[model samples]
Target: MEKMILNYKEEELIGKIASVDTGTAIAFIPDDKKMSELQINQLIAVNSPRAGTHIIGMVVKMSRRLDETILQNDIDDKKNDDNVVLPSNAIKLVFVGELRDKEGIKVNVFKRNVTALPNIQSSCFRIDGDKLTKLMECISTIAANAVTPLSLGKYFIDENSTAYIDGDKLFQRHAAIVGSTGSGKSYCVAKLIEQMAELKSVNAVLFDIHGEYSDESFKRDGITQLKIAAPNDLETANKLDKGILMVPYWLLNYEEMQALLLDRSDSNAPNQAMQLSKQIMTAKKSIVKGTEYESKITLDSPIAYDLNAVLQELHKLDTAKEQGARGEKAGPFNGKLTRFNQRLENKMSDKRVGFMFSLTNEEQELDWLQKFCRQLMGTSKFNNGGIKVIDFSEVPSDILPLVIGLVARIIFSVQQWSAKEKRHPIALLCDEAHLYVEQNESIDAVSAIGLKSFERIAKEGRKYGVSLVIISQRPCEVNKTVLSQCNNFISLRLTNVEDQNTIKRLLPDNLGNIADNLALLDIGEAIVVGDATLLPSRIKVEEPKIKPQSNTVQFWQVWGKNDSTQDLDTAVENIIKQSKSE
Candidate 1:
């Protein structure tokens, strides 16, 4: 026997179907009484032409007009005694899913596919109150039954029922969580992190661009806080013990090094790149002298080498003179490497990017790469299911993209080279992704390199056990290719027309009406639809127990206070020091 998905009483009937399309149907109410209480987005069901199936849809548009019969007759004398209006009302709904009578072991099964359209004059019933709640509960059961279920919050359709998005599906394919500023993008991210923290084993690294997620609130396991080594750290001695990470210049491949040091507009750019490449190979080869790598080392090999040695070699080329037919003549490369040498020297001395040039005793060893990658990729460090928050707050803005790319590339490359059995899955929660992954690819070469690294992850990271959680405030500005690759979307309020359109394009054509409601979403509320979610709908995302620090300040309230003060001297000193730490 098949169970009824929605048990409705005789009085609950709203109308009868008037017309049908490929995936939509129109139903006209028999009277104005039924039309008065109807609302947009209200779920409704209609009898399908196929036996043992019902089509589920949402009220998209409601219209009422004068009945045709009333206009046919008019009498002046009758008008003086009584005035009455006859109205015809109808509602347009797009089919979202269908309820089946029986499917294998499941009875009254609900699916996102409509196998058949509703029949003409089919009775339409409004899904409300108890029926709505039970239907929502059934969806919850589907999520709860998943192999790796992830509870997000309660469904807005029925607050009493909990909402769960399939976690396995969410990460297996890429996913995106986008909204306008203060739309709770951070709140939703925190909820995901809080859940990951409580699990037996979870692995993810959040790129904290604005330093908002550095707090250790989710203590189910420890959360390691890491900061890119800043200028102040150079004077203070950069150390891993304090969670300050130093990415020595030797770690940069030949191309990345050029992006940081080469001036693209310089006429001598080609020569400089060649010289830098040659010197890097020479410097790296010195470390592997008489070893197996001596014959196999490449210029891009991430081996800790002496940049000072490379500097000396470039200086020799800049000033060297060779015997010529006449007298002493410039060497084959004399003066050609001058500009390149100066640029490299300037970057090495610039304290703002000291992280990339500062190489400590421990960082100079051959095993340093392995140690660093382990620290970054190993999420279960010390038996804690802790998330690593990589803070790029102190990194200089101009080179921030390159630095982020450097880290992302390291993790990705290491995973790609690892044995299949040894490789573990890792998700990058990219906060403020728009700053790095831009739709327009020509602005910053440094950022462009970074964008490619991420794009590769979006395209083929699944096979390498890598996934991305692209978090952004401006969906329109993000790379369309990367955003399109996301199979799951948890979108908060997006008021901008372009951003809304961007999301609309990512969704199926039938769900365009749902995308239209992006502007109407409340804070902490989101429209979740994709592979991870079974029923596409809105949900008030559960408040994370450990909230991130990305909160909007109460500017008006602060201005009204009389006790506010500023330490100008201290502020200036911190700015000069390029750090907030005392």
Candidate 2:
């Protein structure tokens, strides 16, 4: 191949170097006629003092042309007198050095050859033309080879040299998918997870709050799907195949327990929570004679400390009568006695009084509480699997935090036990991580496990085979510490300045220009950064072949419907017949 070259006359004006930026260098182009066409981001070659050498650099920017009147008049007079007017376009050339080597330094310098100068039309350095095409092509080839492991059939490449996906690396630490509301964050997450699942080595757990994943019947892939409902739906709840979601009290460390149970102001709250955990474990072991300490406890076991029981105990401690000369003492033993008495009294009382007491006193609600807790932490013997979903859809909003915390604690405990042998690497994917990490909310359990345990996993998870995937729309709403620890990031379109800035700070310095490209990203397109990619890539994310379609409702079409009487008599008859059979 013939070498393309640009020759500059030594007599031409060589203006001084102006400025240098991250991706480009700027210099004053002295030629007045060609200055108007000197656009930003043009490519140019720098001629060095050394012979037969040329350095390639892109023109990131150009200095403004200095307006002068005498120079124009002199040119006009020369043109009319048949005197050749020197081409003002040959003034000066500013060039940015390209990374010719892996270290990204400018070593090759352009050597000017005055004897064999090419004509202006034959010159490779021209304004408003694609100078970086060769360099972009080189980078694009590297990115294309990086994604070979993903097996993405075909993808459209962006013309602007902004986005590409590198699928060659393992993403075993932590990752987050973030974007605006309509920016396809969820679709990207689903697609990414789907691809991961296709990798036979990967085992993932997705916490789907919207029930959108229930349509797994669409994909006949090898996946176990389970739906947990409130204990009310006995038929469906009983049919779930996965084991029940149970967190043994003994599993939480001191700090995690404090976050779960104690008030924030309580100086010894963490210690107390730890003590409470130990006591609960001891009591359960004593209750169930055969179960060993720290062993997995089933829902049917008598030793299991029902959530209702724990709450009832707490209530008793709160409302205990001070031990005067004649009054009962306020302690664990006395509290348990009081709780037992309260239960006995409620059982013996009249229907109205019992009902009122059960509704009013927290201690009196123990029986129903036990049932509720059992439903959440119980195991199904039918398929010999635990019930993973407690079906909190029927759970009241106030106590949702408690349920969430309890479940998180359980997951942490299971992982902690397996951490010793390095078995069964568990990954916890928090869909709306912002909600749990929010400052105001009482997500102590999740915060404890997330910050302490999950953060630890983020830092050292790859070694232990543990990982975390946090998906959130508002990056600003998430904890900065946790966000900073993520080794991988799949950022989608984010219009919010704060969210954009957060991503900007997390990405490496070389990717600053790539971060600016987020706003223009299309749906399902993302700028992938961090450990998983060799470089920041504009990846055209593949959509899951069998993903649940959860787009917004078409209100206009629904509103176009006309009212009609559709056999109310048959509906009522069917309801009555169903009730009779029940």
Residues 88-145 of candidate 2 have per-residue lDDT tens digits of 2322233323223222233222221222222222222341223344444444455555
Q: Model 1 over residues 1-582: C-alpha lDDT tens digits? A: 635767666787889987666766667787788798888888898978887777899887677875645422321123311233322577778888887767788876788888888787898998888778878877778878965568878888789988888888899889999999999989999988877776655778889998888765743464667778777776454366566788888878877887788888988888888888988888888899988788897887888889899899889988999898999999988988788888888988888888888666777888877767766777676434447888898888888878887888888898899999998898998998988877985667788887878888889889998899999999999998899899999999999999999999999877777888899999999999888887788999988888888888889998999997768999899889888766
Off by over 4 Å in 2: 1-24, 27-148, 151-170, 216-219, 233-279, 287-426, 439-453, 557-582
Q: What is the lDDT of residue 21 in candidate 2?
A: 29
Off by over 4 Å in 1: 1-3, 9-11, 66-88, 216-222, 235-238, 382-384
Cα lDDT over the full model 1: 0.81
Q: In terms of lDDT, which candidate is strongest? A: 1
lDDT of every predicted structure (CA atoms): 0.81, 0.47
> What TM value does model 2 have?
0.59
